[model samples]
Target chain A: AQSVTQPDIHITVSEGASLELRCNYSYGATPYLFWYVQSPGQGLQLLLKYFSGDTLVQGIKGFEAEFKRSQSSFNLRKPSVHWSDAAEYFCAVAANSGYALNFGKGTSLLVTP
Target chain B: DVKVTQSSRYLVKRTREKVFLECVQDMDHENMFWYRQDPGLGLRLIYFSYDVKMKEKGDIPEGYSVSREKKERFSLILESASTNQTSMYLCASRRQGTTNEKLFFGSGTQLSVL
Candidate 1:
């Protein structure tokens, strides 16, 4: 079974600062990784996903994640944070068949001015 | 833009009541999924339908069931609502054969069982 682990439960960053959220997964084969963001009272939206080729994948709202197979880690990062970037972030992993997405507990991001 | 819409944004149901949560996708996707979101447990998949009238149990499917009579609509039913079932329920749809493709999600239905 594929499982995802997000180390950070909550993170606080000031506007214009760089941010990184850690994610690690346990899968047998090459896994499909995804990042999702959920604002208050909203559903999860895809940020970006890594399927095969690219080690680094870019997502919406200037967010990106790198897939490191050796370390079993796919961490989400943003060069600069904005006030509107405050939301809950989840890292999910699916098998090769994409049966169902296994999600992390999610990291709640708090952007402060 | 493609979208998934849930019938209710918030619902209040009493214990032992049968609760129905409806989800419809405009993109005509073949796969629809229902998930419940709790504070620390994350999103746990309850059920999914790969095609019309075909359903499958997800990781957590004990108390919930699903119906997909039409191509674009999927509904989740709670046989007997319990306080533990009171949480945010999310509906998602994805295109067929594209497992890596992004899933479109509805705003979600927040159900409260008292």
Candidate 2:
């Protein structure tokens, strides 16, 4: 079974500040990694996903995540964040042939001006 | 754009009452899923359907059932609604035959069981 772990339950970053949200997964073999964001009163939206090949994957809203196979980590990072980037982020992991995704507890991002 | 439409945005039901949550997808997706979201829990899968009349129990399937008589529509049923079942229900769909699994989600239906 693949599981995702997000160490930070809540994170606060100032506007124009660099942001990094850490994510770790537990799987014996290579797993599929994904990052999703959910705004207030909105549904979950896909940010980026890493299946294979490139270790660094780019997503919408200037977000990117790097997949480190050796460390079993897929951390999301942004050079600069905006106030509108305040939302809850989730990290999910699924097996290569799995049908369901196991999501983390989520990290609530608060962007302070 | 892929669209997954859940019938209700919000619903209030009484304990022991029978409840149904409907979901439909516009894109002819082969897989559809039902999930419940809580404060700490990001999302817990309840049920999923791979094809019409084919269903699979997800991580948390107790106290809930699902019906998929058609390919585009998947229905979640709670035989006896309970307060613990009160949460945001989300429906998602994704095309099969690929490992991408980029799910298209509905707006979600907030069900409050009293």
What are the TM-scores, per candidate, against the unseen true structure? 0.97, 0.97
**Residue B65 error, candidate 2, Å:** 0.4
Which residue pairs show backbone clashes in model 1? none
Query: Docking category for candidate 1?
Result: medium
The candidates score, on chain A by TM-score, as follows: 0.97, 0.98
DockQ of each: 0.71, 0.64
After superposing candidate 1 on the true structure, give the runs of residues whose Cα lies further than 4 Å from its correct spot.
Answer: none
Candidate 1 reaches a DockQ of 0.71
Local accuracy of candidate 2 as per-residue lDDT tens digits, B8-63: 99999999999999999999988889999999888888998888999999899999
Structural RMSD, model 1: 1.1
Tell me the interface RMSD of every candidate, in Å. Answer: 1.2, 1.6
The candidate that achieves the highest DockQ relative to the unseen native structure: 1
**To one decimal place, how large is model 1's interface RMSD in Å?**
1.2
